[model samples]
Every structure is written in C-alpha cells, then in structure tokens.
Target: MTGDVRGTGDGRERRNTEIVLTAMRELFHEKDLTALDRYWAEPYTQHSPRMASGLAMLRAAVPTLVGFSWEARRTAAQGDLVFTHSLVHGWGPGPVVIVDVFRLEGGRIVEHWDVVQDHVPAAETASGNPMV
Candidate 1:
C-alpha cells in the first residue's frame, strides 16, 4: 500500500495498480462477477494449471467459486504488470498465501498467474514465522 500505486508518481503505473486492486477486491472479496466486465479483457490467458483454456472457461467457472475471500498483503507494480501477495480464506480447511501476477492491457487484466500455498501456522513451523 505504500508503493507508487498508492501515491508515489508515474500515473500509468499507479493507475494499473489501482485497477488490479479494485478488480481483486470486487471479484475475490465481494464475489461480484460484474467486475469481469469492468476489469478483465477478452482473449485472456490463464497460466494456472487449475483452470482450462482462456476467458470463456474462466467466465464459466466464476460462479462456482464461493466461500473464499482475499486479503491483500502486499502490492507492487512495474509498467503493465502488477504483483500481489494475498491471504485467502475458505478455499480449504485453513488459509492460503497466494502470490499473483497480472498483466494488463488498456487497463483491463489480460493475463494471470499465481502460486498458492497453504498457510502454516507459526506453531507448526520450525522457523515460527507467519507466511505473510
């Protein structure tokens, strides 16, 4: 939140970061599918092995995704790419840490990738460190 996107400078980078944040909040937290129209671009490329094909398949699966919410931990942007580190809930029995990278074109997200890991409670880990 303390990055260029929140306030620093370079309007384009700032705008792109803002777009990604709103899109994630609306889609993941609010579970508002309408965000797709406002924030996503067609011919979308999804790199995650969990999903198939392109935009249409993702669109089809959106409604089936439920009970989960996103808590953004960190955000950064360089040019058209925005990287977000977030904590997710209800996707499984416990929380997950997700590092997502999105590519935007003309202000709409056109490509996406993510790494998801089950959050390990501090008591369970040798280092006693929180994943976030």
Candidate 2:
C-alpha cells in the first residue's frame, strides 16, 4: 500500500505477493515440503472446513497428496493478506480452480482460507470464457 499500484516503484503489496509466490513455488509446485518451515508459521489456522488447523497436521497431509501440483495464475495482496488464483490438480476428480487466501505475519503464512470449483473447459461453459 505504500506505493502507487500503477507506478514503477516497488510496492509493499507487491513484495507480499512475491513472498506468497515463493512459498507456493517451493512447497506446492516444487514438492519441497520442508520449505513450509520457512514459509508457514504456527499455531496455524485453516478455514478450509475439511482440514485441521495445526502445522503438524498440514505437514502430515502434504505427503499424502501424491502427484499433486499447484499452478498459480496470479496473486494480489493487501496488508497482511495475500490471495492467489490457480489451477490445482490431483486433489479432485479433475483439475480444480482455486483461490487461496493467506494471512501472513512476520513474512510467514499463519492462516488460510480457500474457495474451489471444478474446472469446466472453455467450450463447455455458457460464456465461453477462460476460467483462469
């Protein structure tokens, strides 16, 4: 919020966005779960309904997801909150479009919430628009 979003200066929100992007790349995309130690903070809070709310629980769940991957399309941040829109694969019947919200403290993720929907190909949708 410290710089003009449309200008050339390095905005604070842009830095926050980079932090989230780096975490996502190291943890979900690269399958390096240990990166969580550096990127995620606990006592963690998860608002995803099905998942538990501690870092240990999150750790246990990650490896269970075989062949899982996240491909981030874009990210935006405001204050301590950053959200990403992405295509997540291997967790659902097909590729799912996901918007993930993260609350970061001291540059580490402390809480999370997400909305997900099953992906429908462009031709199958009434608007014929891309999902991401």
Candidate 3:
C-alpha cells in the first residue's frame, strides 16, 4: 500500500494520479472518451508510437476503436509522475500487458508514455507468475 495511488492514506500527488488514471480507465473501459478532455491537457505529449501527440488526435481516433478494455493491477505516483500496470484486452491480436506512465501538471495529464507487450501464455513463462 506504500505506493498505491488509490489507497485511503492521503497525499496530493497520489490523489491526483488516482483521479487521472480512473478517468483514463473510464475512457477505455466504459467508452467514455469525453473523460479525456476533463483529465488531459490540450496539447498533451505522447510517447507511444501507436498514438499521436495532442488531445485532438486522441479524440479523432476514438471513434475508430472497435473495442477496448483496461484492467489496472497497480498504480503508483512519485512527484509529478504516475505509473499504471494493466491488462488491455481487445486492443490487438490478444491481451496485452501495458505499463503506462503519465506526467501531470496542475492535476491534469500533460505527457504520457507506455510500454506494451503481448501477454505470454502461462506455459511459456520461466516463472509461474501472471503478467497482471
């Protein structure tokens, strides 16, 4: 619970991270793209190759999403940076393990980056632990 952003223990950075990540989860899982405007800055920076920079670009691509789902397994915040480890379903060929990093400014997300890898089958793992 020490690094948890959603835990009851209080901290402004943790609270802000939780709010933004919850909004993002809502946008992807609930198909409420409008939440982006509330949680993201106008000229948002993107480091993910699959996405273009800016909020407008994101809005433009939303309609093309056939199906999306995000299940966050962990969230942590330190200073202005927040990170989330999650399982993303229906985004590509199969489920993906994604670790997203966000930089917040004035409680809104202004920059973003993510590392996405296809979920490996349990039998393929050297260790028995699940990806999520």
Candidate 4:
C-alpha cells in the first residue's frame, strides 16, 4: 500500500492478496493444480526449494498433492510487498507454519519467497529474521 502497488481504499490491494490466496485455497481444495497457471505470471520465480521456478512445472506437480489446506493470516502490505503468515494443514503431514512474501510488479506477482517450518513444539522460532 505504501511502497509499490499504489491506490487506496479498504485496501483493494489487500483484497487482491486475498483473491490470490482464495484461488489457491480453492485450487487445493479441489485438488486442481491447473488453475495455478491462471494466477501466476509467466516464468514465475520462486525462492522455495520444494517448488520449481516455472508456473507450468508447478502446475504439473499439483495432482500428486493430497489433503492440503491453508489459511492466510496477518496479511500486511506496503507498496509491492505483501507479507502473509499462514497456517498450512495437510494429510501427508501435519500442520506447518508458512511465511510467504510476495513481490508485485504491475499488480501481478512476479516473484515469491517463502519458508516452511514444521510446527514448533511449544518452542519459539529463530527463523523469519530479516535477511539482508
């Protein structure tokens, strides 16, 4: 809202974040990976180790996923940077904490970075520190 993606209101940019997250929720809810392409930019870049860099490859890998559910919380944005702290649930594994950082260019996400940590057993995490 302040740094890159301009415009104001009840924060339509914030709503846009929700839209993408909702799309992802629905896609995973229905186990439809093909829809991912619709939400991603071409040659999308990812900083996650588990996912490949291209949207197409990521889409092709979605069918293998099962019982994945997630919710985005604490979403905050300033300009093109939107940060979300989320809880991810899955059958293949238990719940995990996901920190998702997005970089927007022209209102479309051109890059993404995230870190997934297994649910801490009542212990504080040392991750999520500023990485400069």
Candidate with the greatest lDDT versus the true structure: 1
What's the TM-score of every candidate structure? 0.85, 0.87, 0.86, 0.71
lDDT of each candidate versus the true structure: 0.80, 0.79, 0.78, 0.64
Q: How many clashing residue pairs are found in candidate 4?
A: 6
lDDT of 4 by residue, 23-59 (tens): 5665666666656655557658989877778776566
The local lDDT score (0 to 100) that residue 98 gets in candidate 3 is: 89
Cα lDDT of model 2 by residue, 1-132, tens digit: 111222123466677677778887787667678888988998889999888898887678777887788877767677878878888888887999988898988889999999999998999999999787
Candidate that beats the other on lDDT, 1 or 4, i.e. the better one: 1
lDDT tens readout by residue for model 3, 1-132: 122455334587677777766777667666678889788886799999988899888778766677667777788777778888888877788999989888888888999999999998777888977777
> How many steric clashes between backbone atoms does each model show?
0, 0, 0, 6
Pairs in clash, predicted candidate 2: none
- Looking at candidate 4, the ten consecutive residues that score lowest on lDDT are 1-10
Give the Å error, residue 94, model 4: 2.7
